[model samples]
Target: MASVKPWSLVLVVFCIMSLSYFVNGAGSNEGLGASFIFGDSLVDAGNNNYLQTLSRANIPPNGIDFKASGGQPTGRYTNGRTIGDIVGEELGVPSYAVPYLAPNSTGKAILYGVNYASGGGGIMNATGRIFVNRLGLDIQIDYFNNTRKQFDKLLGPSKAKDYISKRSIFSITIGANDFLNNYLLPVLSVGARISESPDAFIDDMINHLRNQLTRLYQLDARKFVIGNVGPIGCIPYQKTLNQLNENECVDLANKLAMQYNRRLKELLSELNGKLQGAIVVHANVYDLVMELITNYTKYGFTTASKACCGNGGQFAGIIPCGPTSSLCKDREKHVFWDPYHPSEAANVIIARQLLSGSTKYISPVNLKQLRNL
Candidate 1:
């Protein structure tokens, strides 16, 4: 060949590099993989919208801040993105994991993983009966099992197994409702409290969770990030319902949460040790949330104890966020969106920590580390 001109040679190299970039999907989220989320309203996308239950958030102001739905409610309890949604976005997940009950959850949608969480879901079968309908952990797993079968049909058995075990993260943010709606209800929980001590109830929860995690492992789930119960006593609802001071939280509720959290940490440690090739990481939601509530100013929050959308006393937390609820003009300044859920701003802070925080918040490894593994 004749001597190649310098400009022509440079152009050829640039074309080759551009082709490689497109082929490898570099700088793009091509291989971050799917996320299978399991939990209650905290992580629920829109499963409750399809269910006939008292615990539904498909009305206005619920998703007023969720950009995915163009500010329309998508059955999420919060005003915007949940922790799960934020984590997925930060991890470069291409899209939100479609809710299992959504009409579009079939076909190619299932390949991106599925969210099986419901508004009132819990660990025990009878945990949220007051809601009339909710998918407990057992039922969610059953739904996952069915999803796994669908995966087999779509990608064949071996490839589907590999996809699920290697290219997915099983995130569970449950347990709060088991305490909030089950063991803490005054009239409804009287029978349970009398029949079982707090220790006994926690033991039951642990046992059920053990089986639930084991079941997921058997179904080829190798990565898990289990968020321990947060400081539920500090929620706007708890504060308002009990007439607590701005700085005070319900001691009994916090005590129960800490107790269960301790056991849950131990249980996760056990699972990590016992299960081969499994990485069961713990996300310290309690400390993270408590930090936000205690140092709200540091986190750019104006009010940590009040709900941005509700109708009631000081906290505006007795009533859930609805059409006639008192909507706050400064939504992002409030730590909570309603009585029980965190605002999208608070969620962003928590998600950043979980994604790249130190071992103090996410033990063993943070979400970014786990994703790489």
Candidate 2:
């Protein structure tokens, strides 16, 4: 036998220790479970890559910082992982949830979880018609239903039912596109806004979401974290379109978001009480995002009002992030990555909060607690 050198022994010990720490660290809890993500562009994990829509991010500079794809665009709207991706990571998910439409989202891949999110999708079926082929909440849920059947086939009906009910977490982060692309479209929204009051439109949204959640429950989804609409008014797109100052957001847009958020909170509460053995929690995205935008300095962000990758004047909100877009030198210093999404840095902060923050942000139970349940 050959004798080992002192330096080699030390290096071996260091590697062992590092491996132990990783295997027993924050996400080592046995309760860490599968994450089934559902949402819009904010949490979309490349579902749009398969769609023939104009609202795509599978281009240069979109995922320039996403290490998973070797700095290549993976169709995520932001420069890096979405809040969903970060949350999943912090919770110890071994791999990123595969996009439901990805060619590899089959066989053993479905055991971990699947991402059914789509950019430009909303709670309503007609919300993202402008995108031509975007999958709305209704369609995403339909896809999940198919996945549920697949699970039954893979694990047998009884075992699959138990696995879904006890070992999975479903996260839904949607609703912004309904207002931004439907009720607020300058040309098309004129007719919608004229015909329906904000109250009526919001009511429709609530009704649709209620049915959607109920459908998920019927499909054996027991754990849910539903994030409400964030402050769309403060995004670069709204600020640039409205020509507002740094601190001023589009009032109409903010009002609509707040209205929908209120109703969404009520809906979640109702579901929590009505759905047997279900843990439906509300994620206060509006207030959390508003706090970030209002006191970006506190969060160590240099500019919360501008997009790191976009073109046009001021906040660079007019043009979407694309090949010819103006990319920021320090991507981590900015809050928004594009006109409509938060950068990976901002997403990290938000994901941390959602993971273990107080009830003030994530009502009843935070994500960590939800996972352990």
Candidate 3:
């Protein structure tokens, strides 16, 4: 379980993308029927915008690069589309999955899919308590459960069950908030960190995530793509908060992410074996993001260590990107749009790898294979 070096990962990713891997691709709705998105802010389209929570991205400069939104912010926690948006496009989904809480997320809308992700949400409900009112994994699943009921009413019970189990792809990208907002909170986590070891906290996260995935399975999710935690230590927010140099990353945060990923992969494998007819793919986001961070210039990024938006910090990571935040003219040159989220350009690279790259990036099978199947 040794970590892949940055340069090594870059080479592996490049070689994988170059391979002639093929999948039977058909028309949009013919092959990949629908795509259900879960997890936190990274995949949250605009669900948090409807909530009364402080953890939201429905502000200026957040979606400045999203042309589809007419350059207006749509609650995505980035300067443009997230990985989910990019992947859905590549998978031939007609439109971005509507936020489950939105008024438009009813009736025939459930046919294409629904996004149940929430900003500041995590596998554990207590993970982002500082945000006050975010939907955790359990609650998001509850929403999905309701959507399933609606689907049954729309398409009838047998057809709804078949479509959910055989044609849709469930993509879950989450887990960063558990460490960032909960276990590592400077003031709030001191007591918990002392009372419960890192191992204990991670165990709780894994346990909750397992149940969450199982619930999705019981709800008829068959093709699964669960993204592992990325190199959180290398994010602009962590570096600025830790007062690290441009080239440095917070070692402790990276260590925690690595530890969690190791266990998460094992869990995915177990789930794939136990869950009949399930094809669980582990999305290796850690190495992919680390490569971008380490060799930004090689990938056309000018700066990977600094947020393109925000103010009053060495790396512009102290404040979240908002209406009054400083904006970057050339957002494509930056790896991050804010202290936390990746820019749209960066998400494109990540999504392409997940959709078509080799097993080194997405295990067992890539999205193309899962969709074609």
lDDT of each: 0.92, 0.90, 0.89
Lowest lDDT 10-mer window, candidate 3?
19-28
Q: Assess candidate 1 and give its TM-score to the true structure.
A: 0.92
Tell me how far candidate 1 lies from the true structure as C-alpha RMSD in angstroms. Answer: 4.5
- What is every candidate's alpha-carbon RMSD to the true fold? 4.5, 5.5, 12.6
TM-score of each: 0.92, 0.92, 0.92
lDDT of 1 by residue, 26-102 (tens): 32334457799999999999999999999999999899989989999999988899999989887877789999999
Clashing pairs in 1: none
Ranking of predictions according to lDDT: 1, 2, 3
Residue 344 C-alpha lDDT in model 3: 92
Q: Worst lDDT window (10 residues) for model 2?
A: 20-29
lDDT of 3 by residue, 14-126 (tens): 66654411111122345466789999999999999998899989889788889899889899999889899888888878788899989899866667789999999999889
187-289: candidate 2 lDDT, tens digit per residue = 9889889999999999999999999999999999999999989999999999998899999999999999999998998899999899999999889989899
